[model samples]
Target: MEEQTIFHIINNMDKVTNNLIVQWNKVFEEDLGVSHILVLGHLKVHGKSRPSDIAKILGLTPPTLTYLSEKLVQKNLAKRLVDDSDRRIIHLGITDKGIEVVQRANQKGVELRKRLFEQLTKEERKQLLTIYEKLNKSL
Candidate 1:
């Protein structure tokens, strides 16, 4: 609860996240950016989804999602679907290639995390998981 403690926690969290991203990028071997991979992952999990919904869920602006989706569509990793009942409604769906990309990215991510967490003892890992879950639930 002290100011210094909060600052240290936040600083360490940022460093951990940056390190993970940097390491992931090195092993990912994909030309896509994190935002693009996140969009693909979302579509893989959620099936077809409205751009607005994806934007809200991902904490991105509608225009930013639009730009990201445009790149995805161009790469054939995703497609636009027009609602049958309402032509005004549009959804984004991931393709087979997108699924493959997501799977590869996930594997690399898991491997990277495992290597990073291997530094901790089993009990420390459990404590970290519990603490992270508690912090996430607060959000």
Candidate 2:
């Protein structure tokens, strides 16, 4: 690809992500940020996980995960558990309420995508998906 074409793609992707964030915030109007939701989603999928493992999987700093987890615990969405065998190890687990919240957030995300892509024709949408999948595989 030409240098200008690559730059354009990068810039457009950034703008699209920013716009999506704004629109998502407007629609969800939640107190927690996307990162928090992501952590909850991860827990919901993987069951209980160590803090360090969660940080590594999410590509987040330990302190950042700590902060996010603290907020979730405070909100009663998640809880920290001590390992029975190892007193030093702490595990993070999502609560039942957390599962419910993640479910609602996921539904909102689906709704948001439907609304956002409503302007595109079916063929255009399919092409866009194919392109994204190819790009993702490359990465």
Which prediction has the highest TM-score against the true structure?
A: 2
Worst 10 residues of 2 by lDDT: 21-30
Error of 1 at 49 (Å): 1.1
lDDT scores in order: 0.95, 0.92
List, residue by residue over 1-139, the lDDT tens digit for candidate 1: 6999999999999999999999999989877778999999999999999999999999999999999999999989999999999999999999999999889999999999999999999999999999999999999
In model 1, the Cα lDDT at residue 113 comes to 91
After superposition, candidate 2 runs with Cα above 4 Å error: none
Write down the TM-score of every candidate.
0.91, 0.93
Candidate 2 lDDT over residue span 28-115, tens digit each: 7669888999999999999999989999999999999999999999999999999999989899999999999889888888888888
Q: What is the lDDT of residue 22 in candidate 2?
A: 75
Error of 1 at 136 (Å): 3.9
lDDT of 1 at 14: 99
TM-score for model 2? 0.93
